[model samples]
Target: MKIIRKSDPVNLRRTVDQGTVEQRKIVQSIIQDVKENGDQAVLSYTERFDGVKLVDYKVTSEEFEEAYDSLDGEYVQILKEAADNIRAFHEKQSTKSWFDTQSNGTILGQKITPIDAAGVYVPGGTAAYPSSVFMNIIPAQVAGVERIVMVTPPGKDGKVPAGVLLSAHILGVEDVYKVGGAQAVAALAYGTESIQAVDKITGPGNVFVALAKREVFGDVDIDMIAGPSEIAVLADDTAEAAEVAGDLLSQAEHDARSSSVLVTTSSSLAEQVQSEVEKQLADLPREEIARKSVEDYGMIILCETWDEAVDTINEIAPEHLEIITEDPFQELGKIKHAGAIFLGPYSSEPVGDYFAGPNHVLPTNGTARFSSPLNVDDFVKKSSVISYSAQAMKENADKIARFARLEGLEAHARAVEIRKERWKS
Candidate 1:
């Protein structure tokens, strides 16, 4: 990892070009094929990309039973416990429809309604994350979505991972399909004979999937265009070098493009953490990917003061931020932009990633500056409710008509004028 002074210029744009023209062309073609050819196109793309030929794409009851039988009893229990925690946290985020009535006989309110169906995409193959199954689905469930459809790629053997299947089954989500990548996204958005269209799509995937979500955004709502995972550790002399290095590497190992940065006021701590990261990387299973991440994107920034470190972190707006200082909470208010904040030494990034009840699907890139983590709000839509009584219309007709006439919407003025005339009579 490179060590630099705070004065050094850094380009923090995480929205770098993700693919070439050819890759986008292929993704667009896949989307078009899925839209036009439906289930057949989905099957053909599954064979070509995942190298798996499937007779049926949906997960059957027999397969669900097999998934349950394959996992150990203890691991299954853990998954259940995680689901409970996820459900409990999201239930607190559920909202209700409400209305306010005035003495003038006007009713003004907002109605919150869950989307009819939601499609969640989970990546398969070498990267099968059951945790993602919970993070993506539980929110929709909490919001009372009628249907939750899940899509994931099958392995070369044409089977979804037992863990992913088990997680879906545990959550009572039975509508899972063995398809992934841009094709799965297209299927969710446009729908096929086998898979019905969804109101929204949420989850993470590779470059093609991200681009696919971008393309189908207006047709269906998406959580966010997530970029590579990133972490920024703000520490001082009080922070432990080994723990900091371990936490940084946790995100770095996620992808080669992942960035792990350490912003510290103490130069000694910066050097120590850099050395610790090198020592720990040697033993990591994904050493090559993590090493490249550290070498290319990772940095130890030496800030002259704590405020400078906080400013640097806010500027980066990292996906995850860890504060390992004497008083972590003291820095909490200072951090204005971060997808998730992990405080103190014990609060590692993985805790939130796996079991801690909070949604792990977070905003990436610099989007933390504007966007938010996936939540129940992502699966629900709100409609404004307005009811005007005869008396109320008589009281406000002139104001409404004049405002409409100012905008040159004469039809709108006439609509209000007719109501006003009826009320006067």
Candidate 2:
């Protein structure tokens, strides 16, 4: 970790993998083939990419039972509690259709409607991420989306990870599929024989999957073009160096491109954390990956004042932020740009990633400045409702006509005028 003085600037941005021209070409070809051949293309690509030949891609009841039996009863209980917490948190985000009736009988409102279906793609990496399953599905369920389809790459043995299956079973997501990569995204966007097309797709994946999501975005709504993981800790002298170092390493171990930064006002704390990070990295299981991240993208900045620390954090617009100052709440209000804010030492980043209720799918690559964390709102859309009474239209018809005509939209102006004339008759 590098120590940046007050005068120096810290750059935490990673070159997000947008996929090469060759990769993009492959993704396009895959999407086109899936669109034309449906399930045949999906199976072909699944075998090519996932190294499995599946007679049927859907997970059966027998497989779900295996998933349950494979995992310990204690770990399953933990997953259940986590799922409940996630569902309860997202339930608060559900919205109802609302209408406002005016004295003149005009009814103006917004109708909230959930998308008919959503596709959640869980990545098959070094390990299975059941956390991704809970984060993506619970919000769609809470929003009243009737259908939630889950897709993931099958192992060479032709089976999805038990942890992922267990999480889905806990959430009651019965439509799990054994497919992944760009092909899975294509199947979601355009229906196959076994899979139905989804209105929206959500979840994180590799560069190829990200490319597929980018390609199919307009055809079906996507969550976001997510980048690598990132975290920025804002701490002061009161913060413990060891705890701060551990929190920083937790994100660093995610990916080499992952950014871990500490912006603090205390020079002594900064020096101590920098040393502690290097010492702790030696013992991390993912030492090589964490070391690369800390060496390249990590930073320990020394700020002269609290205002400077806050301003720098806002500029970075980190994906996850932790405030470990004596007054974390006061600092929280001052800070304005973070995907998820954790206050004090107890609120560690992984707490939200696993057991905590908040969605872990957050904006990255400084995207938190404008975007937000995934919620029930992502699964549902709003339609504006307008009911103009005769009295209300009569009162404002001329103004509406003039405004429409100002845009050189003669048809729009005439449309309003024709309605008024019909009422006049």
Candidate 1 lDDT, tens digit per residue, 73-112? 9999999999999889999998999999999989999999
Q: Model 2, 16-97: lDDT tens per residue?
A: 5788899999999999999999889989988888778888999999999999999998999999999999998998888899
Q: Model 1 segments beyond 4 Å from truth?
A: 16-18
Top candidate on TM-score is: 1
Minimal lDDT window, size 10, model 1: 10-19
Model 2: CA > 4 A from native: 14-16, 422-425
lDDT of 2: 0.91
RMSD of each: 1.2, 1.5
lDDT, candidate 1, at 265: 90
